[model samples]
Target: MRQSKRIAIIAHNNKKRDILEWAEFNRLFLAQHELYATGTTGKLLEQELGRPIHKLQSGPLGGDQQIGAKISTQEIDVLIFFWDPLEQQPHDPDVKALLRIAVVWNIPIACNRSSADFLISSNLMHNEYQPHLPDYHDYLERNFQEHAIQVNRELPFPVGTV
Candidate 1:
């Protein structure tokens, strides 16, 4: 049996067409996987592709954070985000956070059509591949251990907050 992946799809307002077109072109390939997307994008994609897509809130309305949380919990396997760099967005921070979480989780992410093509076409997609994920528990434990010596010491504002 082929390994079916959980793919998260997102697109900025201006890039929706491009993402839709890309998804249409990759219909068969995408049909083999589980699909998820933000509200508006998911609706559009469902309308265009005629496929079932799990829909979350709109990006600016907490969808990005939802996806980020999914990444942190290892629920998502791939991300296809066609963001528009030419335009500024009100939810830019959320977008960046989502991308950062994907990176930290060590999942495959595609920010454009070329990369998406490569990711989907890769032979690894059909197989069970283990990614080198950061040991977050170990990292937190190390931090706490390093700070154990300063337990009695009062600090100023937290580091990097100033």
Candidate 2:
């Protein structure tokens, strides 16, 4: 059997219904894991599933950042976010950053019902799936080396010289 994972669920205003339906469809599978969500989404899901959820603030009020922080700290194993592409959010940057963190952490993220279905049904969800995470320390060291080389080449130049 797959290990119980910490799953975060988030949905935009327009995509809430879709997420609710998808969650309902996967209730059994979801019940086997730890659940978390943003404000309205969390309340709605808790009511629908009759299960407790670790609720955070509304997205615009910092929920996305909260989740991102958790992802950075390896607190979340999966992300199921149904964001509305047809709509614009005031916290768009926060949303993007949250997604970026998930990617950087090599977490499994599902952006839609289809992908959610696939991910939930995949054998990896129930089993240990080791992700190939980037060696950021090495990358930072390489970047520092490159920056030093560039700085060395630009040193001792005349102030007004091209």
Top candidate when judged by TM-score against the true structure = 1
lDDT of each residue in 1-162, candidate 2, tens digit only: 238889999999999999999989889998999999999999999999999999999999999999999988888899999999999899999999999999998999999999999998988899877767667999889999998888877889743576
Minimal lDDT window, size 10, model 1 = 151-160
User: In candidate 1, which residue pairs get closer than 3 Å at backbone N, Cα or C atoms, i.e. clash?
Assistant: none
Q: Which of the numbered candidates is closest to the native, going by highest lDDT?
A: 2
For 24-49, candidate 1 gives per-residue lDDT tens digits of: 99999989999999989999999998
lDDT of model number 2: 0.92
- lDDT at 159, model 2: 38
Give the range of the ten consecutive residues with the poorest summed lDDT in model 2. Answer: 153-162
Off by over 4 Å in 1: 146-151, 155-162
TM-score of each: 0.89, 0.86
